[model samples]
Target: MKMQAEVIREGELEKRSDSLFQLWKKKLVVLTKDSLSLFPDGHKRAKGKELGFGSILKVDCVERTGKYIYFTIVTKDRKEIDFRCPDQSCWNASITMALIDFQNKRAIQDFKSRQEMEQAAGKR
Candidate 1:
């Protein structure tokens, strides 16, 4: 069964390459409630890299220029990925909000599980 994730936003953003040249390339980004998918080309049908919210530590706004707002996404493995979008686009805020919502949902689930374990222990 394929899981359908709700789309929060979709737009084009420039991502800094990790290669030696560190060139910035425009990517087609699809922000979902649970993950951010980056398509190299404009075609969404192509294979893309999916960054699950579970592995995202935080999204930090690094700087803002007249043309673009720069941000970094820190992952669980401490890898930082840089991205930039037009200042008016507010991509940083969108990603941060989505990340917060995902984290809150995980926290709530953890709390409920702990409560259930406590109740079981009391019964025992």
Candidate 2:
């Protein structure tokens, strides 16, 4: 529990606001993952296996303009991400598909965890 709390606190990056999404369209979300639950659909689209921390981002998208792809990050306080990568055509669709699956799985797991906790409390 302590480790999980520490990880959540450390792993999070501040959320960007609606205005930044309006201005830029989308942003990439990365995971410092050791292993990701592989997705079948996404597996078909992969150019190659992502190795270690070399996986630049798990997903990328442009938010506002129908997801016209770009690379930038602007926090809610209007802080700009100075970091830039070489212009590359990102595989948005595949990444998006995989991320959706990941999120659904997480949601289910969270619900189950809550149920178990509630059951324990009732028994107590």
Q: Considering every candidate listed, which one attains the maximal TM-score?
A: 1
Residue pairs whose backbone atoms clash in candidate 1:
none
What is the C-alpha lDDT profile of model 2 across 55-123, one tens digit per residue? 223443343334234433333344343222223434334334544555566779999999999999999
Q: Which regions of candidate 2 deviate over 4 angstroms?
A: 1-90
What would the TM-score be for candidate 1 when compared with the true structure?
0.97
RMSD of 1: 0.8
CA lDDT of each prediction against the hidden true structure: 0.95, 0.36
- lDDT tens digits, residue span 1-124, model 1: 9788889999999999999999999999999999999999977999999999999999976699999999999999999999999989999999999999999999999999999999999998
Q: What is the lDDT of residue 84 in candidate 2?
A: 23
TM accuracy, model 2: 0.35
Window of ten residues with lowest summed lDDT in model 1 = 60-69
